[model samples]
Target chain A: MDVFAFFNLNELAFGLSKLPMFPYFDMAHYIISVMSLREQPGALCVSQRSPLACWFSSMLYCFGGAVLSALMLADAPVAPLSNTTNLLLATLMWYLVFYCPLDVVYSLASLLPLRLVLTAMKEVTRTWKVLSGVSQAGSKYSDALFVMVAVGWAKGAGGGLISNFEQLVRGVWKPETNELLKMSYPTKVTLLGAVVFSLQQCRYLPIQTHHLTFIYTLFTVTNKTRMMLLGSSSHPLSSLESFLYK
Target chain B: MDVFAFFNLNELAFGLSKLPMFPYFDMAHYIISVMSLREQPGALCVSQRSPLACWFSSMLYCFGGAVLSALMLADAPVAPLSNTTNLLLATLMWYLVFYCPLDVVYSLASLLPLRLVLTAMKEVTRTWKVLSGVSQAGSKYSDALFVMVAVGWAKGAGGGLISNFEQLVRGVWKPETNELLKMSYPTKVTLLGAVVFSLQQCRYLPIQTHHLTFIYTLFTVTNKTRMMLLGSSSHPLSSLESFLYK
Candidate 1:
């Protein structure tokens, strides 16, 4: 009997996708943007920064997923500031993360139990974006494998790809800081996933989207958990490589 | 015009209630259990602790809200170990928190961004438990305001109330560590909320359940945010009192 016969990957993927991950992903994106801006030299402090600049920087990061996917597919660039509720919530989250009195929100967010869930959910969000991007591109370019991969890759790692622009919007110029020079594990994994998805889309691989989702989710959750546990942002398997090679 | 006329708080409450908070709450409770066990002296470390004791202790915390509410309402003591999925997930979490090599899971959880979301969601879970407990008791004894309050209080602070028992299950009892003598701010707030909910049930207060939920959410979020920011587990308003009285 096939081991895979007992479990249905599609149903599992469907259930996982039903989770309320959008808000968590949105918040995670905003937090990353704010943190990235803060990390830049000569960037104004949260209190000193103009609200418009801060808001613009945040909008860029928070909506980068959608905007970049559209751009990758050569469609009209969807305006990032479309939803009022999303905008309001993002602004509130930005304020809380940076300006909450005594930095309480930041400290609470730093706790382990909460952090683990957010990180896990954020990965789930990335997987969803990558999958959607692949399908979206596939619909437009049915015969173009390269186009499908590129679109998915763009959707998955768009935030990083656009970091220079995001930073410029905040009046911080650091062209030296390119995502290409130091691609994050998530971005690399997304590229690989895009290729796999594109292959599957072109009938070169025999697997369902849900199957791919399950695989991606498993890989990411394990990788993230390992990264988080080791307290290292480096590749999750780097320790193994170091141990084996040394 | 009344400021309240501008908003449909009930709809807001309904929307908030729809959030996938159960899983987050369940995980938060399990994390707290493991943390509490770790904090005790003479207790075996996670790796050393018997799996039975760990599971039992975690189950007590994870299912405390539901079980305590049932008990308070004079219902049969619900079996905590009924759900296989929840049990399996709790076990996995327990292992991850305790036995993950290098304590990486714990470290990731210690981060600010993720922690804040978890803490906020946990408070939302608490507010939900209190409301449900109030209604559960109210149904059985419609005119019994005291019963409603008691049930709500138990549901809200049942984990603390049963902490001693939980520790005892781990073979590390500490009678001096009574919850009442050192009541947490959450417990105090829950007590106040219980009274308000009970009053509302008894028709002495003019407010809907959603209205109370809105108030509770606002109060807890602000209070927890303050506490987390100050890095003090003390009451959120204590600083205000010190400033005023000083």
Candidate 2:
């Protein structure tokens, strides 16, 4: 009950106190969404203005927004957090130690729209400023009950160092073998080269609907055809801007 | 804007209505959660207390609870599903068709505890019945925004039948090759056999911590292990349980 009470009371205290605390939670949000989209291109990648665009957009915007608020309350740092102001200045040590290994990124995304709907009853009566105020406030605090998961190979921090040490002690490998298992110099160079190549391809892809259609159709019919796109943000518009205007 | 209004106004109506329509939404809530957990077991599964017990209990209680709800909402062919329920239901369907292929399970688990905190503030004054009623209502609705992803090869719903037809029409496959990709007789039987093997292993594993330690530690270490399990929902207790009783 004390554990429950401390969490509940501090939440009330958090709502009453106003400070910009949104970025911490947002940083921890929706890893699975980003990862899956990156990993599963053959299955999930969708072109814009297709029948799937609105769906993807809502998911990216709303469900994406959903994860930003997952830890707003429960993860209020034990002390000094009840009155936190600077969102970005703190060290991320909490994630290193107390992180629950659960994948809780979707919890917030799933609930956010329902919260909006429930709040809509007041929309007829409340001013736009008031609603916007609530949303702005919501953005500052991510949900707290769930854990950010131990970091992964992608982010480079999931206690793999400790595990590797323990495994080494347990006689999984000899010291010389372990050195061989690590990424070699050529592998690192190849990885860097691949990233550069993909980024270069992003610039040449036809972006506009008609331009892309004509170009792609021509390419498909040609005796020798080639196409390339890499490092494009899921949204083609953003990808186009990355190479062009930006 | 029309999209936004249709969703908002209907939610307004849903809140006003007091009908018992809990079964549908719960069905859609946990697919994202379950999928992520299953996919990232190395990162997420906690091996503590009665390891198999927690795993099996969570599977039997939640997954078993889940499939029951899936049929409930998907089969809501009953009439008078409210301007509200229809809005919620149709939007969910839209998500299914246009769903981002990203696994969204982590999003909900992260957010649930935070919502609990916010609710706790009101709980200070509210009657227990009111809190339970709200919780009961919430369980029925599940998380509303995230899509229950369309069933695919992972969940076994993407039939190779239509895919083959589309490929044939596109001249991408010979009909014979397409037929070959579909499951053959022995493959289907072997798949069934694999599932049976897994469930059997699940049953035989030390779901009860006491039985497991007594049986295994006795076999391996032959002496003792001192483990402290503060809380374990599986087997209703831990190794200390056997010492307490039989």
Best-fitting candidate, scored by DockQ = 2
TM-score of each: 0.46, 0.17
Q: On a 0 to 1 TM-score scale, where does candidate 2 land against the true structure?
A: 0.17
**Across residues B25-114, which tens digit of lDDT does each residue of candidate 1 receive?**
767756655655555564445236355456556667766666677655545333333354666677777777767899987777767766
Give me the displacement of residue B174 in model 2, in angstroms.
Answer: 30
**Candidate 2 error regions (>4 Å):** A1-40, A43-58, A70-246, B1-246
Displacement of residue B243 (Cα, Å) in model 2 is 61
The second chain of candidate 2 has a TM-score of 0.19
Once superposed on the true structure, which residue ranges of model 1 sit more than 4 Å away at CA? A1-246, B7-10, B42-47, B236-246
Question: Interface RMSD, candidate 1?
Answer: 26.4
TM-score of candidate 1 on Cα atoms, chains taken together? 0.46
**C-alpha positional error of residue A15 in candidate 1 after TM-score superposition, expressed in Å:** 49
Q: Report the C-alpha lDDT of model 1 over A51-139, residue by residue, as the tens digit.
A: 77776776666667667777544455555566777777778877877678998877776678776766676676778778788888777
Model 2 superposed RMSD (Cα): 28.7
